[model samples]
Target: MDMAETAAAVVDRQADERVRLVVTGMTCGSCSARVERALNRVDGVTATVNFATGIATVDAPRAVGPERLCGVVEDAGYEAAVQSGTAALDTGPEDRAAAALFRRLVVALVLFFPLADLSVMFATVPATRIPGWQAILLALALPIVVWSAAPLHRRALTGLRTGAMSMETLVSIGITAATAWSIVTLFARPAPVRGHGVWAAIMSADSIYLEVAGGVTVFVLAGRYFEAKAKRRAGGALRALAALGVRDVTVLTGDGREIAIPADELTVGRRFVVRPGARIATDGVVAQGFSSIDTAAMTGEATPVEAGPGAPVCGGTVSLTGRLVVTATAVGADTRLAGMIRLVEQAQEGKAGLQRLADRIAGVFVPAVLALAVLTAGGWLLAGGGTDRAFGAALAVLVIACPCALGLATPTALMVASGRGAQLGIFVKGQQALETSRTIDTVVFDKTGTVTLGEMTVSAVHTDLDRDEIVRLAGGLESASEHAVAAAVTAHARARHRELPPVTDFAALPGLGARGRVEDREVLIGSPALLDARRIAAPPGLRAALESEQRLGHTAVYLCLDDRAVAVLAVSDTVHPTAADAITRLHRLGLRTLLLTGDNTAAARAVAAEVGIDDVVAEVLPAGKVEVIRELQARGRRVAMVGDGINDGPALATADLGLAIGRGADVAIGAADIILVRDDLAAVPDAIGLAHATLRTIRGNMVWAFGYNVAALPIAVAGLLNPLLAGAAMAFSSFFVVWNSLRLREFRP
Candidate 1:
């Protein structure tokens, strides 16, 4: 099959069996990428690792199992466990880790302040140098270096065992070497004071770096604490959504007795009762009751929807003021709330293309920095610099070249953007959509439901018979049909209080219309094609009236009696108020707009003209829509398809970027890359605007992260920066990247 055909088939295929793992000890992007690569090496497996969320989504054959995946990650020197229930959204472990780091940071700061003051006293007034002050400094710095940095040491040893290098390895090497040197200096006799030249003074001064060892540990620990906190906040939206579901619910037993049970135990075909201000237990239909439902938590819509008997309600939505007796149709993972949570989790775990570049660089970053540190030490010794100078320069290089910022640059930005998008009622499936949306040059919109309100209503009528009789006869025949246009005619009759005659021998002619005996008169209601097929003759001016209605974008249905045209009913879908302005905004963004529909030429053009669309492609079948997307792609134009129907599914999956209206069919929503939660055309432009802004943020973060490393490395190698300053700069680099990404939270689209 061709590419378009293959994409269409992909949407229909069942998803591959997958396993989600919560991985620990992933300090940088390279660590996560390493786990991902190891899992992908297993037979029949594809793995994606998200560093920001620390989750791995692996798609593997059923034969592989979760144990094998966890084993592979463990072998790669990280910890992994299968995640279930609400464990994926829990941040308790991260919070506990942060709390532990905070305690260590406080201890380090308390001891280092006095130790630093004594070092200054010894340097400024030689007579005030207390005996064994160096020993006292070493005693004070020991716990901060050994105990406060225990986690770093463990991870660093794991990297060494696996023959890999990470940010932890760099930190561990710097701290161990600096502390070991300080201990040796305290026991050995002090070097003699020399000439006042800068190099001679640096060589003659005491070579103790006790403050460097203690300060580096504290700053690195603090950086990790804040990084963990920021990551939790970035994923807070999905966690909050998962928390909205009630654990226990009041279910009405088959015997009509109410009992409390776990929400997961509520199975399909069961009945449940919800009281005022209570959340609906699961996806179900209201059997009896009336209430205003608050769907804002589930759909991001502000207004409450009215729920009555036979109305469908979703899980996690609250009932405002009335009791409801609902029959459960879906429970457990089958509920709409569960599906939305799955989508959000998958989006968080997926990686952007730019992040792959960062991962590649990070994978080699530590090893390269190690090599640079060795060269700096060797070069200093060969140039006649003392061992003190050589060791200090090497320590500075090891402490300064951090890969954390590069690792965090892209994922943090994407995390913030996805969370912000969720709040704005736009669900971005993954980073690919965010990247593709920014470059789209053309947008093709499905006219019905996407641009116009999907609801059809009877707009006008022309007939020789009385209007009441025409509506009554048409409603009788249409009552047996389930088409939208038929429903519109029947609804109009009901609203007018016109009694529908009994419909006998009702037969639905598939694509044409419906025919039946209404009060002993043969009634036919459908398109003009049905009348033509039945050899019916229209009355004078009937053709002109039908043409006029069609010209105004209304569907004209002809009612025939005994093979004679009796009346023409015009049904039209209302255009959304923001449709024209949305088109204008897209034009302002320099994107070409087209209307694609299965409606007739005149009706399609009329709506297109009304909405300010630049082009119209009408009378196209569902399969043909895919070809249109392919043809546009062939012209080097990136296309984003906006649609909201089952027929729009294939095209949506085939387009470069697919945006489905929230009220669309499940199939369309499943195939789309982005979903506009509100059925408003204005969200189309708003989504695109948000995509552009998010991409810009990602690029800006990458530039800053790369620039910092490039500029700092040389200064450390030249011994212009001391180890303590280098450590501070390294920690600040990571914090700066995260703070830059948080700016996306203020995005207003």
Candidate 2:
């Protein structure tokens, strides 16, 4: 093949195996489009842009790496960086730039205040029409426009060139139109004496009003900067999770030598050596080593985990002692650490109910504002108003109707509240949970470990045969199982130091129990249902013990021989230490709490009373929980399901808001919109408080942003206000909205 054909073939091969680089830097929609265009131009590349988060993920040839991509972005007069296969905290270099912009904006505003007063006086009084004063006013306005508003001008031009209409477009067009109209009239020669128009031939210092124009630009830009910064800060939790991946690893080669290599270069099935005091490079299993791994990063439990052969170890876990050869099971983004980071980022990015409402409103807000401006201008001209009056009316309509406030109210507060939540080990999915938590009137809690400690302690053991022998044999069979009840049984036997025989043909029956052949004798350990199916007869005394245990809300497991019940073992679950206090706190906050469980009614009711819960739904299957939540919702109450189990998944997803106890089952976490990482029931109340605070702040921002526009629009259009004063008011309005949203960052809960 020819060289060109060979090059094309190589490009196709690279494209087939390409992995996208998830990048961040774009600030506006135009930036998104620009990045997409530039990346698509590369020989073997494809890209997708998310304007909301300003992230662009590009799939490209390895030869056209991230450094080359960053160069392309810089060349286009913007910024870009390679994501280090890690989660990114929202606040970064962009926040610093915003701070600098804010400082410049504040300085510009201070300078414009005095100039605003002078311009108003000059417009009202016809006496200060001196040419020298007008020249000085115009000259002073020049620096402010070109210097203070330069960023907006440059951005606007870039956006227009890329065929995208940005917020800067509206601001630049309004200010430039106003300034050009004033400058033309100021230098215009005397036209005539009859029916003279205002600003027709009169050269007043108010004509250029450059301070007013530039001040508006500076303030709006400042607000935008701070708003973006707040969002970045709020979203940084996921970035911290992403940074846990090990940077380098010690690869054990076939030559029996070890060499340092990048973690990304290590593939599945690779043998890597993790020395004492070194972190593991990937998710792997110990093959020829033993050590205690510090898993505090993933599990949040400070105690180190003992790992010998066949024990699992994740990337970034520190090996406290002993050398180990590990076989890599997962590498790169497939590692458990990477998966956790992905889940956090995905959960944060996912929109909740309230944000969807705001976005729908915003979709039509811009077009309506443009139409209103057009109508206002047309109405003014029809009423015999001059071009200057018509232009002023149109500008007022555009400035007042801008969705600047509406667009910011929800996401800004969510970012702030979620950021604060992360600090306390609570992960709120997004604005949806924030809004849902505030509105939920009823909180539903799962019984196991959520409302009660899931620990199953052995309460009593009874037998028809020799109690010691029965107990020993039962414990030996149970020791092989991982179930909670099995652990309790095994502990009892271990304490007695009884040598229990082994079991063969071991089988686990879901929700019923386990069975096996012990010492060539068939032994069955299970619930009453399992014993009934096998036609085992329980002794009268053992039946009484089972009844007593059931009445007290304890689980009774039966140990049986070939056809007779040999022993009765009971296990009881206790209420959590903090559960009662958390329930009381929720009640004080005006929320009603309920308990739902798969346990029998007697057991559920007993636990509910102990926890001081007013409502109870007992004997619920996984599907039955959904019905219970729906019934509560139908009673005009918003329900929040708090659980941590696969059975809880249905109810959690069906509720208005699902709060998952982080220590619960994986499926529970997967279905939940809010995760309480600390697994403390008290965090439930804390999350609720954060939600209310965040929603309150969002409303405050909306009221301030929209309220300012409503109050300022009439004054500007009625000719009672000059552009300088109007601009200042507008600037303060934007700043007020942003500052109000920032208050959510301080939410205590």
Candidate 3:
């Protein structure tokens, strides 16, 4: 089989059993990759590691148990625990880890500063170097190295045991070597101060690298502390989403007695009561009462949606203004809120394309650096440089070459971007979507429920009779039908509070006009074709008016009395108020916009003209929609499909990027790479703009990370940098990458 087929087969085989693991001691992307590789090495297993959330999602055969998965991660030099219950979403352990790191950083900072000052004092004034100065320096460095750097050493040992190397390995090796050399020099005979030149000073065995050991430990600890805090902020959106679900609910029993219970305890077919300002406990249909629900948290729409009898209300939305009796249709993981949270979490856990490359490099990076350090020391000694000089240069080389920056470059930027996207009501499904969005040149929009409001309404009514009388007649005939256009007419009449006279001999015609005797008049209501088929000739002005409504994309239904055309009612799906502006914005971004719909050519063109879309592909079936996307791709156009129906599913999966509206079918939402929770077309442009910004940030971060290592490596090898300076530079490199990625949080479209 080909690569795609192979992948599909693998997905099919592994779809049955999946486990989520919360891993600890992952200092960089390399560590994450290592764990992933180890899990994948197990028979019939596949794993994806997310560095940002510290979560690993492993797909395995039924034979592989969760314990085996955890064992694989543990063997890969990390702590793994199967994520279960509410703990799966909890960040308590991470927060505690961060707290411990912060405390270590504080203690290291307090001790390292004095050690640095004393080292500088001793270097300048030999007289200030007391008889037991070496002993005092060792005393100061011991606590910082043993306590502040404990996590690094432990992780390094774990990596070594697994035959892996990481940033932690580099840090541990450098600090241990420096501290060991300092202790050795304290007891050994001091080299004679033969010359006052810089080379003579560099070769002095009397020099104690106590400050280098302490400073390096302190700097790395501080960097990790900040990194941990930034990662927490990046995951804040998913946590907030999880927090939105109501913990408790009031369910009405079949006998009408109300009992409060946990929201998770409410099952399908159960009835729940929601009062004003209270969140709906689960996804359900309103059984009784009326209220306007604020769905901003779930849908990102600012306007409150009116929910009356039989209207569907989802979980995590607040009932505004009135009480509601809701019959639960879905609860717990089955709710839309739960599905959204899962999508967001999965997105955050996925790695971008560039991140994989970084991980590959990082996987071998520390070992290569170790070899380079060894080679640098051996070369210096062979060139007649003393042992002290060679060892110091090697220590500097080990300390400066940090893979931490490269490992952080992509995931951190992606994390920030995903969180910001969620805040804007755009849920990016994964890193691939964020990367693909920047290259999208064409945006294909589905007409119904996408560009238009997807709701039918009466736009215009042309009738010689009284408008209210015409509406009453149309509503009276349509009240017996369940068609959308019929509902629109009936709803309009009801809104106007027009009373309908009882009709006798009401005869319904399938796809034809309905004829009934209303107050002794034969009333006919249906399409214009129904009038023509009945041999009823429309008046000259009546024909012209009906044609005008049809040309304007309205569904014109002719009303006749006693076999004569009396009125033309124009009903159409209303276009969203923001659709035109959103299309204009997409155009301004240099994207070609197209309307893809199953509507007739005239209707599609009319809607396209109003929205300023450049192209229209009308009268296409669901499969044909996928063909359109494929054709666009064949023309080298990277298309982004925006839709909200089950018919849009194949096209969504076929497009380079798919954005599904929140109110869309579950299948379409599942197929899409991005979800527009606001059901607004404006979010399309915003999502693309944010993607561009995020990609730019990732590129910037990569350049800095790579450039820092390249420039610093040569300087350290030339003996221009000592271990202390190298540690500072290494710390700065990682800090700079993370800080640059944090700038993404300030992004505005």
Candidate 4:
């Protein structure tokens, strides 16, 4: 190819090879600038950096990758790493470094105690001027500046060279200006004063302020470190979501060789072998073998499900005790695991207006402070104020306006609150969920397994002849069905181990009942309609049994023989012991609760009244539940919907915040924003409380962070403080704000 064509192709390749990097050890504008310069110098690399977000994106040749770029970043004393596009990285490392730096800086700060006393003694003792003691004091400051403050200087210079501003930018500017000014005044000859004899200048005291600058540098770096680490740790839920899918799977090749290959390359209808104790490679039916599979990771249930031929196996579920040959139905991003990862990624990247407001304030803060400082100094200088006074004002402006406090406030509290939530078996997802929960004014719950214990029990068994014979016959017919009522009847019969005669010509009528020939006698078990169609007249005793069951809101299955009323099987939904208490708790919290379900109206109303729900939407489909949520939202009510079925996906996705009990299938969890690992209704309250706490902390941090800057900037620019002292105070203030933010770790729901 010609050079022009080759260059065009290279540009196309560059556009396709975009990469992301997480860079650490950045403290000031100089640090960012340095990283930008170093990365740009590498072959075929284009990078964009947002100093506020501390995120960097690079487009480079595939051969010049993130691993290579990371080397360049680390060589400069910063840690550069790659993260998956699938999940948020943890903030653990950054938090630890911040903690370490903070601990060391505290010791350095304490050393300033003796230095302060010495300064006071020197100031108070008018006749004592020991040049030797003064020189010794200056020399003693070597450890504070070089050992303690070096990281800040290094990061600041790097950021400066790379054309970015960071916390180090202000510190470097304040410290360097003060140090140079003091050193020059100490050695240089003073310019001749007009109409006055030249006066010899004595030793300068301004240099003593460098200790403050150095101390501030160390402390500020510590804050950033913790902030970064906490951010990473708070995002652990996203990491678990990312780790759901299989990276590679066994592939049956056309050459008759069974080879392991990347899952992304697997095609639909391709058959593969799943070994025992290994996760299923893709979503497919078991083509061969019989065994139990543990789907707890995907379904969040401890039950090991039995799978036979044609049973759908989701990817990421282990085959605990069985080997099976499976056909690849879905792979890579199409698998259930990938679907969850995509959902989580969308939540992380979708920034709401409220979330971005913090950044907007931070964006304009630095430049405004810098401008104010310049104006303050010039105004004082033009009024015939001494150069020293003007410089002091300018130093205050730069030192006092640190934005680290604002940056760490909300995120730190959010991290702690989310962590506490995870410990309580609740996943808050992100800031959106936290904010949404705090705003939720109404809660809608699913009927089955949500407001109830999700189990069915035999309420009554009525028979014209022997009750045992009726139970045995009905249970034998119901044993073939997987429905709740069938399980209840089968379990009741099995408890007594009653001998059931074989039934021939069995038939199931969904949602109604079943029919079969028992011992050559046609027997039917179903609802009132089936008996009415058969024209069977019930005895007075059977009528009483039906009335009592209906009054209790139990499901009554009528039994008939030879078109005559024979027996009636009664089943009732089990109510959870905690459901009523949870409803009372919600009421106490001033929340309105309602039940939404597809169950019969009578049963729904009974459950709702029993649980103290104010309203019930009965015989409603999954979409109907979502519609109800929307109607409440339209009425200016914030709503939260909790569900655990694939049918609930739409409602779960459409609610203000969808909370899926982790006991559900992977599809359900993927649909909801928050996942409650424990199926307890109490977790709903726990999650809401945690969200409130996190939001409060976020607001608290923002107030401290922004409030500090507002109070400090004016003091800095008015020249009320010297550069050295201003730098130290500014560093300490920022550190204090961050340390306060770290207290979020102790938050509990």
In candidate 3, where is summed lDDT lowest over 10 consecutive residues? 198-207
lDDT of 1 by residue, 612-632 (tens): 999999999999899999999
Give the C-alpha miss distance for residue 16 in model 2, angstroms: 17
Sort order, TM-score high to low = 3, 1, 4, 2
* lDDT value, residue 534 of candidate 2: 78
Alpha carbon lDDT of each predicted model: 0.85, 0.71, 0.85, 0.68
Give the least accurate 10-residue stretch of model 4, judged by summed lDDT: 194-203
lDDT-wise, the better of 2 and 4 is 2
lDDT of 2 by residue, 1-749 (tens): 99999999987876553333444444333344456667778787776444445555666777777788777655554566665544364355566767767766766666666655555555555466566655755665666666777777776687566554445656676677766765675567312222245453222233444555755665666666666665565565445555567778998899989999988899999999999999888999999889998876664446688999998788877899899999999988788666566545544454555444444555455455567667777877888876666776666555554455555555556555655666555777655677677778899999997887787778788775777787788888898889999988888887886476788999988898999988887888998888788777788898898988888788898888776787899887867888988999899999998999988988898888888999888987988999988988899999999999888998999999998987688899878888886646888888898778877887787667557666766665564455544555655565566577667666664
Q: Candidate 3 clashing pairs?
A: none
What's the C-alpha lDDT at position 446 in model 2? 96
How are the candidates ranked when ordered by lDDT, highest leading? 1, 3, 2, 4
Q: Model 2 misses residue 726 by how many Å?
A: 3.1
The model with the greater lDDT, 2 or 3, is: 3
Better of 1 and 2 by lDDT: 1
Model 1 misplaced stretches (Cα beyond 4 Å): 1-16, 191-206, 462-483, 498-544, 558-568
Candidate 2 lDDT score relative to the true structure: 0.71
